[model samples]
Target chain A: MSPESEEMMWCHSCREEYDALDAGTCKECYEEASETEEELKREIEDLKSKVHFLRLSSPIESDLSPSDVSLHASSDRKGVYPPVPAHKIVLMSRSPVFRAMLGGEMEESRSGVIKIEDVSYNVLCSFVQYMYTADTLLNEQLACELLILAEKYQVKHLKFFCERFMTSRISNDNAVTNFAFAHRYNSKNLLESSLALILDNISTLTQREDYKDLVEKDPRLVVEIYEAYLSRQVNTAASVKELQNV
Target chain B: MSPESEEMMWCHSCREEYDALDAGTCKECYEEASETEEELKREIEDLKSKVHFLRLSSPIESDLSPSDVSLHASSDRKGVYPPVPAHKIVLMSRSPVFRAMLGGEMEESRSGVIKIEDVSYNVLCSFVQYMYTADTLLNEQLACELLILAEKYQVKHLKFFCERFMTSRISNDNAVTNFAFAHRYNSKNLLESSLALILDNISTLTQREDYKDLVEKDPRLVVEIYEAYLSRQVNTAASVKELQNV
Candidate 1:
């Protein structure tokens, strides 16, 4: 086709539409643009996917979940959303006793304090790493705030460093007990995912020596876990195949 | 064998040991106890298997993940998990923004200042459901606390209830970010397990439209996610295999 008679195409990268005359350079550019656009779309999707996985992977992934309808009901009746600056939110998180309980897996019961930095693998390391180099040590909330900031800015390395560090110590009891609350808060999905990951550990514990002790200590739970396990689960084809192998 | 010297088998339900213990009601409590104890071992194994399943299923089912290091470094600081909390993590997740984002299937941009929840679907949900239905709510953290209390008190229902609630929402991002800190603070295995799960998600995004976008947005990330995917991923086998037309 003659250049004069050929159609034009738009070049997003160049920000100017050009002629597609004979599959015009414009078309070439648009295809290139499409490749670019397609690439951007893919990146956003990928980042989202990563976030999803990270949320599930966190030890206390159930942070976003809420309290029960009745407990919140009286409060909800007064207002739909809780007040901002979330006084109770922060205060509730600050309980040293709760923290002790939370860290009970490693720490002895409510007899001690559990620093936020101490819990996360990365943040603890970061705090320790930066303690010498940096002037100030980050407090628990500050650490969480920093993590939120890192996430917002797409500071991936920071997120990993922080998240992996913190989630490193999420407990099965923690994952299980907090399940509802995690879903209630702003971070339900991540919490759930993490719990799922931990379930295997808990499941294995059902038969392990440590868990055997746990069962001997709390046979009732072992029984309940068994009932619940039998209720909702369907055998995986892989598992069924494994069964056949056995 | 003669009836006078038959082997005694224990009965599970009645706690009686019978001779070659065929299934039967035993008036002898000691015999029944012996029978029940023997069967308990097998039941414990079954419970362990269930718990194991509970753990693995979430990370596998969640739709999110983390990003690569080098490529994501530019837009990010080479270390940050994504910022936007998974809608599922938010409080009253039935809120408008979530409805819109999830309904629209727009994973890129989150709208409004969404509220966070404190719920979960991990192993604890089932048990927690039975306990504390009114006035008192088991927030995610509280739920975790409750699970611990349950564990301490031998309240198996509460523990598993929390776990199930937690595992259900593992796909959303917000929970992961928030809880990682809590988890890491309390446990180590939970952190590593979470890291592995997030890593798996990162791998899944590659070679798809989302990963392609990462490449376009930041060419450097291309190398990262790709590398991560290649390292951990074996194959993406479909759960249901298609039959070929002959």
Candidate 2:
């Protein structure tokens, strides 16, 4: 090797030689940064262990759940499902709506039997499982159903989880329907994301079936979309004029 | 600057010129490391939010806790203390012992009252609060008391937490007592750490008051310590002999 090339700096991390222009951090800073990374990794491990410790086993994990209360899902199509047992403390702790319902002078509180209307047995079971485990597998349909249930019971954690799931799945096909759903449930994250996707594909908006359904069901949302489009056009024109002046 | 020195590399992190000897990492490696750090930090934040969502507010934090069960600390000095209200589900979820006691046809479950003997009222309250919050302010005295309670109830999470606290505070003076305590409570982490400390200070072992007390209280533990020391000595001697042979 030439003398100049022989004097090239080497990276402690990748163990590769680099030219002067490719330098990253000095030895002291590298050591400090490595320490910081290790500390962060250790913290993540600790938090993971804590989460595992905090998570309760789902009632379905055992035949006898030792539950103090039972729930019946009263569905229109499937009829009254078998009773799902749950702990009162867990129910109350996870949702303020449940706390109020179970703590007050209500028949459900007295009887220890909560009858939830308009939800299928599967949805009800998943919701109760999420209360114990703080986790659930979600598809598009499950996310939609859970978001509504989360909103109804005021379970902010589950609501946020569902909103995040739905936001990631937002696309041209489902944007209109998701936007309407977001507005109905007051899900700000989902609403903003769906609006952005809809606005980006504004030229092809009216052709979609969900768009026609939204317009028929909620014409005010369609008007708001046009207003937003107009506002965007005006802002773009203002920026163009300012640039021309400059 | 000299031409040779002017050719030196500059660190992006510390922003200082460095020679080949002081080189740390290449630019690509540094960027990748930075991204990994950011991802880990984001994960930590997510896990923290989950923990916050899972943590239940202590019933003691409220004037009228919607508690269905109450605990009384039967203290030796003060007799029965004021009832500390708690939820059965919370207790049962945290500890298998509590689960068995509350789930079966136990008198405490039937009466909705549990008597915890051989603990102060303050300690009982703190234990219940920790069950809810997964946190507590700890001193050596409180750590010892809570460790005992955690062991009796088989609350592994709290037991590990107390063991960590006591391990951090292990020193020459407390080594003997801590070793004995760790053994009694089956805290393997604390026991190993305390034993290591005691073995390191074996030359002055008999001079400490706690060491003498341990010898009187449980001479078998002292023999075990000596056995461990002798085993360590034999290993060291073998390694030294192997080196000499080489």
Candidate 3:
């Protein structure tokens, strides 16, 4: 094709001249795609607003009067944190564990007070906040802490949220630790990502302090990791052999 | 280009040979567009799941015990409908009107029982359900009912939801009526859509029974519609003049 003819061609998106190989979509398809993109974006905006609308104002934030239930975060020390006010309906709806505790003929239900032991005030507050809003600002430390709380409470949504955050942050340094945490919590998504990271760095796995700790604390978990690594290797080899035959 | 050369030209999307005039995007741009589409879809899925997680189960369905407040629908009849149970926190969070009634030392707040007058049991139930779930099935009638209830309670989200439904269902048949409803409710979105529909069929508008009623009931609204029509006409005339000069 001549340069003059090439210059005649235009992109519908950026509206610049392009070679046939540089073309994206035809005019009709581009218009259709633009409409679809707009529609998808509008849907995202609508869903976001819905999420905002559904998010309950946190009891702590609202300073709501006459909250039905109060949760106390009891540390190992004698000093107990101030009570975290919440409702039984919200607590039960968010977690089956909370439901079992608050819905049944339990002392917690009767007294309208539940003691959450071994958790700091911050984690307990964040956990309750997440139940109301389905959101929280998370760091690695917060994610790990919240993941434990989420798992214990059986709040699958928050567990998944924290697990996803932790999984994305997984690296060679924390792979073994994350793998162990995932295994303990039964977070399948986190477990897979962490185990894959561990498998990728198998040569340097034992040198990590967490690896030694895992081995001491749970030998079976270490053995299972090795088994997964071996299975992946065998699968890779089989795929390569099949490709060679083809 | 010869017929044989034309055979080489193809669209990546529809997989069809096309002339230069029919050319869409190039292969590289097509691939990039595909990636963008996939990312948008993934985002949509994530948002959808977040919405699902955030949606609180309606109290009616859950049969949750220990509900803190009760809503009674009082019709002028001798028999009052059964009270709809709900949490005060949900009510306050969802509606500013409910918040004021419940949050302050109002009669409802003191008694823990709110008598919602003029709404039937079904509409009141659906209203409560929407407050919890952010969802309710809607037909034209239902949407109208819900929109009224939503506006009365200052539930902006639900009011918007119903307005959108009403707007989508607008036609020449109902445009004038919906326009009046929108004006009454101060629903700006619905008002715009309904007014546009009315303007589009302005030739036959005044002949409509609702238009006559609106003229008799509110001459000011009718005059405003005419003013809007005149402004649009003036704008169109100026645009035409500019095009002719060019």
For model 1, the stretches where C-alpha displacement exceeds 4 angstroms are A1-125, A128-205, A216-224, A234-246, B1-246
Q: Ranking under TM-score, best-scoring first?
A: 3, 2, 1
Listed in order, the DockQ scores are: 0.01, 0.58, 0.59
Query: Cα lDDT of all candidates, in order?
Result: 0.36, 0.86, 0.85
Q: Look at candidate 1 and tell me the lDDT of residue A107.
A: 47
Docking class of 2: medium
Candidate 3 clashes between residue pairs 3 or more apart in a chain or in different chains:
A23-B25, A23-B26, A24-B25, A24-B26, A25-B24, A25-B25, A26-B24, A26-B25
Q: Candidate 2: global Cα-lDDT? A: 0.86
lDDT of 1 by residue, A62-133 (tens): 223321111111223334433111111111222333323433454422322323321333343332222111
Fraction of native contacts in model 2?
0.62
- Candidate 2's residue-wise lDDT over B107-207, tens digit each? 98889899988888889889999898788899889999999999999998889889999999999888898999999989999999999988898988668
Q: Pick the candidate with the highest TM-score.
A: 3
TM-score of 1: 0.18
